[model samples]
Target: MQFSSIVGQGEIKQRLINTVKENRVSHAQLFLGPEGSGSLALAIAYAQYVSCEDKSDHDSCGVCASCRKYQKLVHPDLHFSYPFFAKHKDDTALSFIEQWRDAIIKHPYLSLDIWRGYLDAENKQANINIAECHQIIKKLSFKPFESAYKILILWLPEYLDKTGNALLKIIEEPQPNTLFLLVAQNQDQILNTILSRTQLVKIPCLNDNEVKQYLINEHHQTEHAAAEIAFLSDGNLTEALAMLNNDESSYHDYFLKWLRMCFSNKGLEIVDFVDVLAKLGRENQKNFMRYGISYIRECCMLLAGAGNLVHLPAKELDTAQKMISVMSLPMAAAISELLEKAHYHVERNANPKILFLDVSLQIVKILKFKTIPQGTHYIPN
Candidate 1:
């Protein structure tokens, strides 16, 4: 992924290019952002630019032998360490390097959960453990075989456990002409030692315009549809692209239905809906929960006469507006919290059926949490 080829984050790319020009490239840097924000793309592009023999001001020289290798992710000096599931306690990142390369080659915006799906993991947890740290040390011990600087790109360093800390010391002070680019979505979860050693780069999500353009050009999405999807995607390019395929919109529908059901206190209907959600795979279930949260937020804006602040389609906004008319604002707040908790539990591998059922019941009950009439004075009966 060349820097110029990436969609957004012009300032970040310029900063990286300036580093090379100033001859003050940090030995280690962390590209921290939520998924689909082009962090990995920037890392690879920066690596190529540093390695390119005849690089230009704006981008890497794509025709260089070094550039060609990095383009294919076969560059000798470009190493990657990431979370992967092993067959037993012995599984490691090196075991799946080939598959990892292939996956990223196809789509760099993917999540770790997407990668886990390729490894035959059926809802099992994966992480980059201590053993991989030994491998990383061995790889960095050698000098750059071809490039000016050897670059190590660690995707999702948050998955690193205690054993992984051993490699942090060397990452802090790699041999001359070496660079470490650690990409993580959550910085607070990483070890303090590792966090302190590297320069931190914050990559913000793409704006709605940026995402909408990408959809129209790449997915042949209609202009109107692309605009609305971009708004609802909330700066997540991964989710925007997914919505382009139409399958993800089902979650939005489900969310709408669930909200209406809760507002009406339809007990039997919500119970059946919970059963269906419980049967979905963990990833899909998590997605729906996220969708629910987003819709509730939009609905809250509707209740507060901030409809213009919402990103829903005209029809969606109209529908939500009607629901908001009958729905209590306090109840919406509570339901949003319930959905937030459900997403958190889903992330932690909670039983989705139980979680959804509990959440549904809470939503039903929240519908009954009454607000006192404004300025009504009451005496004890």
Candidate 2:
């Protein structure tokens, strides 16, 4: 991946470029950032820049043999390590590197969930096991194949178990020209020894303005739609990309239809709701659930005299206004809590039809639930 193609984080991009230019590239580097911050993208660009025969101030020359190989993730000297779930004939990560490369090339904004989905895993977890760590040790043992540096990009070191220590010595003191780049979404989960060995680089998440601009330019979206998506995404490019890929504005449409049904006490509309929800892909279903939970919290805040904090769309003002009135303060708070609980349950592979039905019934009840008198207290200790 070219550094120029990455959206936002101009300053960090320049920092990476300068590190290579001055030959100050650390033997071991840890890139810690939240998802959608381009941690993987930055690492790839840095690897390409370091291997580029002719590099520039802004980015690498994309025409070089090394550059072309890096773009396709086929560079012999540039290796990747990420969490992978076992599948047929792909019981180990070393066996699945080709698929991993293809998936990332297909969508660099991917997350662990997306990776698991690509593997068609039912509910298995993704991890970088100790065996994969050994593979890294074996691969980097040789000299750099034509490139100036042998770059090993380990994405999500947190997935490594107790067995990962086999490669600790290698990572601590690799071959003369090898570079180890570890990318993590959660820095706290990294081993202390690993943390101390690598130079830490923090990547900040994208702001709304940055996200909006990138969406407009990359997706050719209208101004108003882009602004609304940016606000709703809350600085997560993965979430924003998933939202745009749906083409149906599934959450927005469901949010509007669901809220209207709730406020108008239209329980008869449950069948249509179920039908529409059943059609969504797993990612979009989860996205809608997350959005609903957040939106409900916003509604509660609005009822509690925090309307200014709500990030409602310009077009959603009318619906928001109506929802605030129809949903009593106590009901709003209760519904928010219920949705939050439901969200957690959904994330754990709960049956969606049953969960949605139960959640829907609770919402129907909350729509008519009466509030207690002010200053009321429940005794339970």
Candidate 3:
């Protein structure tokens, strides 16, 4: 993909281009960034720009022979290695190349969960096995086939096991004109040996405006809808894109209703609400609680006389202002803590009905009886 096609990261794009312009391109580098930050896309665009026959100072000429091949991800010089469900000991990333190409081409802000959907990955663990590492070494052993550099873009090197050390020789002393671009999210998970051998390229998450504008211009979402999704996503383009088909716009209303029921301690209504929550599926339940957490934070900010820092849209801001009238900063903070714990449990496969019911009871104790949680002696501001 071209740099023009990737969203945000204007500074990073320019920096990559300047690296090529000044001929300071490193042979081995790590594109380190949070998920949905366009690190993988940047790596591919940089490789294409480096190998482009008719390249300009800004980017690769899309019409050149090398550029054409790179656009389709079929270039002989461009190889890719990524985490995959290995069905056999001999299976490697090349074994799933077709699926990988399709997944990346369609969703450049790819995540492990999304990648799992593209395969028949029932109960299979995704990893970069020893076979793949060996393949990577063998692929780079040859000279460039069509372009000046033979590039290997390895995605999620964090999945590489202790066997990753087998590739250290090639990584440290590679064939000339070979580029090893490793795209990863978690630096702590990568083997120390591999981590120390590469130059670091840090990529920051896209700002809210970048995500909001992309939804408006690309997805044709209403300004308000884009703003809401952008707020909920919190700089994650992958999450923003995933929310496109979801009924995320209703989260605010549903969350408010649940909170109101909990505050009233209406037993039957809460039971029904918990039932609905239990059936919304695990991902939706987590998202709903996340929305509650963020909304409560805004309420706390308003109660603390920091409404200026609130980013809620107009309707939500009005609701928050009204809601904070009855709830003190301490109450809002306690509810937020409950929601945070609920979100954590939801991620760990806690039974949704029991989890939500227990959280609702705790919230009731906080909102109705003004009872501080046993361990947390929150002082009202």
Best lDDT among the predictions, by candidate number: 3
Once superposed on the true structure, which residue ranges of model 1 sit more than 4 Å away at CA?
264-266, 368-381
List model 1 lDDT by residue over 1-381, tens digit each: 688778889999999999988887989999999888989888889989999999988889899899899889999999999888766676667789888888888777867666877777757787887678888898999999988888899999988887767987798677988899999899998988889889999999899899999889878888988887787677888777666655646876787788668667887998899888888887778778777787888889888878778877676667778777766676677668778888889877788778987787666555533332223331111
Clashes of each: 1, 0, 0
How does model 1 fare in lDDT?
A: 0.81
2 or 3, which is superior by lDDT? 3
Ordering by TM-score: 1, 3, 2
Question: What is the RMSD of candidate 2?
Answer: 3.7
lDDT per model vs. reference = 0.81, 0.79, 0.88
User: Mind giving the per-residue lDDT tens digits that candidate 3 earns over 161-194?
Assistant: 9999998999999999999999999999999999
Give me candidate 2's TM-score against the actual structure.
0.86
Steric clash count of candidate 2: 0
Q: Which stretches of candidate 2 lie over 4 Å from their true place?
A: 87-90, 247-249, 256-279, 297-301, 304-310, 328-334, 357-366, 370-381
lDDT of 3 at 353: 90
Clashing pairs in 2: none
